[model samples]
Target: MCGLDHHDDSLLEAMLENNLLFDSGVDGLYGRSGIFEDVIERFELLVRRLGAPDKATRIHFPPGMGRKTLEKSGYLKSFPHLAGGVHSFEGSDRDHAKLLGMLEAGEDWSDLQTPTDVFLTPAACYPLYPTVAQQGAVPDDGRLFELSSYCFRHEPSKDPARMQMFRMREFVRIGTPEQVCDFRESWLERGKTMIEGLGLPCHLDLASDPFFGRGGKMMAISQREQALKFELLIPVNSEETPTACLSFNYHQDHFGQTWGLQFEDGRTCHSACIGFGLERVALALFRHHGPDVEKWPAATRKLLWED
Candidate 1:
């Protein structure tokens, strides 16, 4: 296999065997089938309909974000290992000749690549903070935004649920601590209900972002202690290690401070966001309801297919 040795990746094997996922000859990367895409689209539409009453401002972001924004966000300090930086070949004619020679020789020609202004976005909400800050301050009542993007993480795994590139559909709230907290709390229940309605077995649990390094251990502990994060878990790959298909988070002034986001009253705004891992959710559906949509429970199909 492409850069991967023999491993008992049961879910991945099943997906490949049944033609639900087309192999890219690489681990953690595959061509999603049309059936998979349909599920994701229907799920997202259902989410939008359910969230309509919230009147969140819809904002779509590309898969890449500014390198400066990523730097200022301190992502490198916390999760540098997961960040994907873009590099480009910015060279002259002579350099091009050398690069061609290296390619022919099968040498590592990527060292000549220069860092580009863009980096693959780590989360759907990462770009929203800076965008809001640029607009000056949040309103007294607070602000809410709906965002979606293809996020990139460096970790490659044998589990089909863990893809390096995936879609994250998020709803973000910015305001005082109370406002943000309320949003996360509501979403925790809402997310669970949505998943349960689809007939999948799931539960909500306290969770933390996978922070990095020695200091990150402390951060992770603090986050859990404060209950800053919660995840809607479902058994996609295995029951022992349930996949976090949905997450509700409270970012108590971290993004506010980094992006200089402020409220109309001048105090820094607190923020929270709920992220739906679209691909993971789809995979979970496939796992629980069978790869063929026609064979799924009627209620489940109606929930996804009906207007």
Candidate 2:
């Protein structure tokens, strides 16, 4: 079986009952236990080990990325519904006193919150573009970067696999069109194999990003029709609508134009990226292989936990 019958909170309840995760009272927001964290850490180690041969330049960023960068990426226009901008109290002393009074009087004062320059990064690769453009030109041979970030989206869900805040480990490639396409095509199989190596049944499907609004319908359809995006789905939540555990995307000069990325030959660069949802992978492991790590399949255990 791919996963338990998840008509209710059976899996979430089981994990909570077993101390694998702690309820945060909010749906899609849970405090992971140490055991859960260990699994994620070891899985990331496996990802790094598998990707190490590529010599990707590793970079890390905090959960919040520059809001200006996000704006320039066209994310605000395309996925405004899902994007999350950090807001803070940027008011004067009188405003602060009013906020305190509101709290004391049981009034909602969130209206006083001000938008900050930092936004919760929607994707791991969002912050990499402008940073690379700032470096002047892509190397002659091309550029591959290893990046990971805590990303946020506004979608709240009861599905444990779909968290509002999650971490994505991504490998991004920027180069000629051929190079970018090849990178995306290669990873479609590589990512599936890696997930299967962890003993999860997975399949690849042409997919589209969750673009917002009526106009976004056309955008999503166009994305799928162009075969620009794909997802590696696992039966974590249910069979009908399985979870997207990993995603592969190809941006044909979109980011290049936006960020002014250019190759050493002065040609516009194309980019591709493959991202792994670390939490969903762990959840898949737990859902399929049983909650207790001590009793997991020996082969899967060896693949992920071997020293």
Candidate 3:
């Protein structure tokens, strides 16, 4: 019951009993109840402690951003296995019917569609690059943007902490190479400090992107060579295995080139993001404190409820 085997079931049932289900999805339930309110209160306090932007940065809110940007960012080239895009086929009603039948039998129906221009945002930062690119050249001073977005993926497992669709509150900044690198490095320490302060046993680790295929393996190798990503790992359920709760990535002009984003100096703008998985953090709290809300630590419990 401590692992993914029962994680989804236990969390889902608890959420349901607590009336957290606002809608339903392929997974049978979705959305938040008062539970998210608890998570948000703590998150806001944490962000304030970390000196997050006083306001949401230049906003670009899109339901479905373009797929081409993901391609140019090497998303498809690197992590194709984890990437998901929208697909449709004409004259495939019969095929769709068969797929639906399989779904009724508990088989995945995603294989039936012919993917189109749309794609599932595996990471929250996917849409940010293209949106910023559309704005033309970045100012010499740089640009800062934040998006609280719902993102999707076919994850390694149905672990409650590793959801197929999760809320990601991401802060993105694009500008000179020096600025981007500095920003990312700064967050590395801040993120570690914040998580550690929350009383969660966590550690910082160099991260490698999960590449798509055999060729993707090569692209991931290149990313590693460039020292592109880092993640904060914490023990959620089992102390033997840690889960990545936060990840900071430095895109290093890769996205700027894709979106034709240039700097005042006529160089491609560098990019980086600090990502927070809201649900996973909540799950971490549950694991740390125990299932009974009454027995949870006073400091942690007070953060969630004002009344």
Candidate 4:
């Protein structure tokens, strides 16, 4: 209800009443209803089936990652505002007493908590870089990983498509420039086809991340100019401006140089990743097909529920 316009409020009510989502009474943080979880599971299975021939290495990471890796990933430089650091109480009994008093009095008690070694992961691919770098060099054909994680961002909005915490399923490829670039390009089309198969109207478009400040603005422009990022957008909340349900990115030696990732040939490995926003995609399906899962199109139900 916080700053949500009439349209968003109505949509939120519908979703809540349908039991597709459970609001935490906080913007951007909501619990998934049973149907939501079921849909996500089916979607992930569908994604895995689509990529089965690729034989990508599957890896699932926890919601948080080491702060050091986040630093090394250069996330702070670009998305400092969106990054979330985990913190916990690390004080003595006296501090605990004070914290309790403050909490009881409805005063600020967060100061007692200190930052931990881990930070909430910002992307599905962030932790993969350091782990891959530890392996020394990539193989001749390079490495491909299927990664998924719950990513956290600080941005909160009335638009349900934009959530502070959401799951991202990504396929990461590392190899020569051509190899990585080709991987990204292939997924660009593949993503479109998969979404279309679900009967969702979508389009791939040139896009860039929302960078932080003045310097970030320049970085965003440079990224777009280099054609490094693209997103598959679908109309979720509005038709005029669509939400990005999937994204493809090419990091030309940026991560390689940062994490010492290299090819067997003594050259830095270029990397590309295709990420699917699981929640957004499910939400898109719900918006398009209406709330009742049993009433959805026969083809859609068969595709999701049947083999």
Candidate 5:
């Protein structure tokens, strides 16, 4: 299914068989088992330890965010195909009755729900911009935040690395261009080190977002040309092509301009973020260390679970 070959299909089946993952009958939506979730939590703790010195402000957001904030983020302009809006039944009892009738008749009823004022968050850092903007100008030392959220994208695939709804852990920096660029550069190496410490081989490469449509092609090209994005790749599903488990992005004045974020000097701030794909990283660990946590390397287990 979904153009998956024998090898890929087998790998997916193995995960299912081991009880690390549960198939939800949807390609990109699956339930994580207890062991799988434990791995993710341990990984997050490791990340916190690695980043403790930064003293970044920590924030957690839910799966959905204000649609107005999303509009200001320009997500629709870049990746409309991957965006998801939340809808609910905001109709009268008559409409509800009709919807129930349709459901009983085995017909469409989802249309009865009107679009809500919120949308599923596309990234962990999308809401930060507007929040910071509301707080006023940035300090001279700049702002750094540790943020995590359940991000949603509409791209369904057999490749387990590309989940439609997944958790993203991000370290966002907002400051002058020099400060933000430095943060992104430093995280490139930090990301590699973090993944390698988990017993997974990883490499950093220049990358771009999967922007949508013809115009998006140009945006991707420009992003690559400007060296605005980088990803830490690992062999989760395939050793040859690899998958991106972490990303470092430098949004030079993009979010600042969008949200009217500024520095004390009255110049727009620059922004950068380091994102970790929590599920993908956990999967990579499982792929390398096997499904049984007891079978994993002692050092790796200690690093993740003990100290």
Candidate 6:
């Protein structure tokens, strides 16, 4: 939505209208062309405009990360429904031989093996938390880190926008609670302003996290009550359906306590993140503006291709 030109939206809508939505995963990424390049450039520009300080703090992680790291950060305990992990053979050589035989006989269930340590990263922020923690305490003041990470989830729905794997560009700020909260709030406003300025149909809403189970349900409620997460939703494929393009979260003492990160006064630090789903926004652009690149607004196209 931020980087697309007016005619670009028309072309996208036309493609979707013609049922040309390529299943980027499971089936695989194909026929992306300039559409993808534009998306990346726009995302970078958007991040820069969002006041990320500079590119030095930026990081890029492949779609997958280790399961142990995610588990240690309480990802499974919170959202086990979205958790995904790798499995491997656990049997002896004889058992392996039997399994291979089963496979040759077309009766194998090799997919049932228990996991080693690999898991799909559910969010861009997940991988960064432990890295920051292991790096030792936050500076005497604070630290700002940005990342454009490809993340994975298991919501295998038919929506082209909500793919199993997607991109997330985020800015994480870690420091004291006050600093973290302030940073989150500031980004919330900034996100809204930028979206509005771009003429996208969006709204800033109080958000509830998808915590797991009854206990997690209570935790989610309590977290929202304490103003821990906020999201910006915009209509993408359909007016009835709004995509969550941006999420602002305040992890008040959560990561800090878990990781032993300290501030200037030696108190545990707090953390917050501002995240954007790069692909989802691209989908939104298609929905709102249509898909003909040539027909896209000159101003918007210029902004996207500027850098």
What is the Cα-based TM-score of model 2?
A: 0.95
- For 215-283, candidate 2 gives per-residue lDDT tens digits of 999999999999999999998866678899999999999999999999777799999999999999999
Candidate 2: 10-residue stretch with minimal lDDT = 1-10
Residue 117 of model 4: what lDDT?
Answer: 97
| Alpha-carbon shift of residue 281 in model 2 (angstroms) | 0.2
Error of 4 at 12 (Å): 2.5
Global lDDT scores for all candidate models = 0.89, 0.87, 0.70, 0.88, 0.89, 0.73
Question: Per-residue lDDT of 214-238 in model 6, one digit per residue for the tens?
Answer: 8987998898898778899987745
How good is model 5 by TM-score?
0.96
* TM-score of model 6 (CA atoms): 0.84
- For 67-122, candidate 4 gives per-residue lDDT tens digits of 99998899999999999999999999999999999999999999899999999999
Pairs in clash, predicted candidate 5: none
Model 6 error, position 59 (Å): 2.6
lDDT string for model 3 (99-187, tens) is 87998999877667676887777677787776677777788979887777667776644346666777777778788878878888888
- Clash tally, candidates in order: 0, 0, 2, 0, 0, 18
lDDT of 4 at 118: 96
Q: Runs in model 2 with CA error above 4 Å?
A: 1-9
Off by over 4 Å in 1: 1-8
Scored by lDDT, model 4 comes in at 0.88
Candidate number that wins on lDDT, 1 or 6 = 1
TM-score of each model, paired residue for residue: 0.96, 0.95, 0.78, 0.96, 0.96, 0.84
**Cα shift from native, residue 78, model 6 (Å):** 1.4
